[model samples]
Target chain A: MPVFGFYKLYLSSDRKYVKKLKNLLGFIPGNLSLYRMAFRHKSIATNVKKGVKNSNERLEFLGDAVLGSVVAEVLFKLYPYKDEGFLTELRSKIVSRVNLNALARKMGFEQLIEYDNRMVSNTRQGSLLGDAFEALIGAVYLDKGYEFTKDFLINHIIKSHIDIHKLEQTETNFKSKLIEWCQRHGKDVSFDLVENQEGESNKLFSVHAIIDGEVMGLGKEFSKKNAEKLSAEKACEALGI
Target chain B: MPVFGFYKLYLSSDRKYVKKLKNLLGFIPGNLSLYRMAFRHKSIATNVKKGVKNSNERLEFLGDAVLGSVVAEVLFKLYPYKDEGFLTELRSKIVSRVNLNALARKMGFEQLIEYDNRMVSNTRQGSLLGDAFEALIGAVYLDKGYEFTKDFLINHIIKSHIDIHKLEQTETNFKSKLIEWCQRHGKDVSFDLVENQEGESNKLFSVHAIIDGEVMGLGKEFSKKNAEKLSAEKACEALGI
Candidate 1:
């Protein structure tokens, strides 16, 4: 009972944690346990009993939903007459895994999060940071509610970090466009994985977008679809379609 | 501006809408315009010059996010010890197109929703119902805020209609399990569209789950994936894996 009571007090009274969170979140957290859970990765969580849950996973799930809601609302408001598909595509571009990961890293969440050293490396850090960023939103929602969370996302995340204009200009999926173009022109298009080289830990795939028995575009990436997409972008530029 | 002013008064005073909504939601909505928009399908919308927006699509998008948030929160609280993946899979099952469509239809939302009669048929009704359901939830959120929306979902939607226990027991993705089972058993698994018969308006797909060049399961549906899934489910039962 004393240990449980002491833990609660420690969560509220931790000066270093308060300062760190204040710096990270730009405000003092009302409930410290939520924030602590936000930063606590499952890899380093101490197992107490079978039914006991520990880690940011649940919070991450909650935050992801809240974040999606806020983002969808902002997009809906911003693009008044835009169709649902347009809004969905734009939102996807902004909240893409790579985009979120980069944004989280830029916000210094990677440094603030706690995880097992053995579980994390440079290769897997991107996803970790993105998950932590979502978990933070979950914590913020729990501590301050939807309006406060929405304000934070609007002022802090979307406004400061995300460039909607630039993102709009950047075509998120070129391959789909290229395929559509080819279909309209009565041309058959196909992608072939020409090369797959093993990296230190992962395989790199090289693909060629072939059209009418000609290699129209060539691309190389860590994944086959991406490599094909890169080649398709090149093909699109070449064909001006 | 008198017309606009009068419209606002009419929305609040509309006895039929209020009564219907009260019966549906257990409370009167504050913002009737949001609810009106929620039921206002794009096909039935009257044109009011350029740049003016109409229809429930935007609200549907918003409601989708809000619904997702509520569902995630419910799942998170209910399954405290479940991993993120498990929670995600469960949430997906609940919010899935088939599930939502069935739930919406069962709630008699199709009869209440405003849509163009020319644009809808039995074949295209599932998505319409699902979208309307999401839009209704969106309207509820806008009218009553998060707590009220959460309450409506918990009390009205999940409590009365949804059987979480039954849904938990149901394996939503039998195909994935069957594939994994086949892989473990060193059997090649493939789904072949053996029959595709054209109906009056739609095509019916008949798929067979082929295991080691043997037809292990047979299924028929309007869609290929669903047919394959039905077959996969049969396959799972037959193999007892």
Candidate 2:
């Protein structure tokens, strides 16, 4: 009877912890176990049962992608006129590792993290904070639906930190700007594949944007166009036309 | 009044197009010019208006991130028990360039694209399809809220094409499986960093899994762990232990 009472008390404590988390997040709890596992760093060496996996690294990975998506979705909705570059810059700013780490610190997640004493130095703390931020995101997505995740991000991250107007203007059309500068002063622009090499892992392409038979820029990247764009930008700077 | 009549017809056609797009996507049209600009390709040379930008590339960039988020969200909900690796693989499968192109093709986006005849071949078609897919996604986000985008993806992409169970089992946690197998079979598993190179573009690492003082497998990747995992898979196959 005493053992049964102890078990009942343990269950109540678990419920209370989950309730506390829900209050902190401003959302209902769906899978508190997942959230707990998510906060458990591998360094802690906790006993994982037969069916369970270890650490929140997996959750962090999932959360990273989820956070990226939710942020992108919000950016899309908020800036209807913004082009891809603008949206990307904004999303990057919002979900940058530094920003995520800051948010994690704000959430008091460092206190909850279960890391080894040896890894408690200043440098490790930052990385752990970043990882915990990602884990929290994973936990959030698991606890609530995507809508809630989006709303949470919008309220917590974007609304508080990001300057939407500045992002919109700065991230606007680089390619167009380059092209316009070229055309306004009567110059022809073309991207030529200078060298294309297939590496052991990824294919690499070196591109040069030839303007009036002069190589304006030279760049290399995994994709031809991306490399070409980099080269084009360099060329734009070089020519000053 | 012929010019006025022409303007009236143009407005009506625009309205009809917007209405059809809204019906398909579920978000009310936010900016007609932005939408129109989103459908434009760089190949379609036109007079540069003062404030107007060319091509859907920027929108495509924004859409790419948005699509990634939406797909991530869908996968998260669909596979609650699945780990991060499983979620990533599924998301990648859904949002990969190949998959996006297929979806774009299904939507009959080729007809809607405003590209030059030179860029309409089979090879260039994939990029076009991919871009259209992104633009469509951007359009959908604008036309519908985040919920609608999530629902559309679930209905159109996940339910229709993706095999959730297969994705969940095959793609993620390969490293974990390897570790478990080693533990069960009483074999020591260790990832030895053979080479770590920080290149200008990417950080490259080579890893070898030394099982019983023998190089069981060796692989190279942008990431050390990823390289180690690849090596581990090879080791598993070679040793047959």
Candidate No. with top DockQ: 1
Against the unseen true structure, what C-alpha lDDT does each candidate score? 0.80, 0.67
Q: Candidates' DockQ values?
A: 0.30, 0.19
Off by over 4 Å in 1: A1-13, A48-53, A173-227, A230-241, B1-13, B47-53, B173-190, B193-241
Q: Residue B101, candidate 1: how far off, in angstroms?
A: 2.2
Summarize candidate 1's per-residue lDDT along A1-241 as a digit string, tens digits: 5577446546645767777778877887777778888988888876545744578988998999999988988897898777778888898888766688789889888767888878876446557888888899999998898889999999988999999989988976789978987887788998887633212124767677877767777677888778889989877656644
Model 2, A24-51: lDDT tens per residue? 6666566666777777877774545643
Model 1 Cα shift for residue A44 (angstroms): 1.9
Tens-digit lDDT track for model 2 on B1-241?
5576446435878778767656544445655665676667767736355433567776676567667766666666666556666677777666766556776677666666777868565445566777777876666666565677667777866677666666545654446766887786688888887643222224667777776666677667888778878888777657532
RMSD of 1: 11.6
| Candidate with best TM-score | 1
lDDT of 1: 0.80
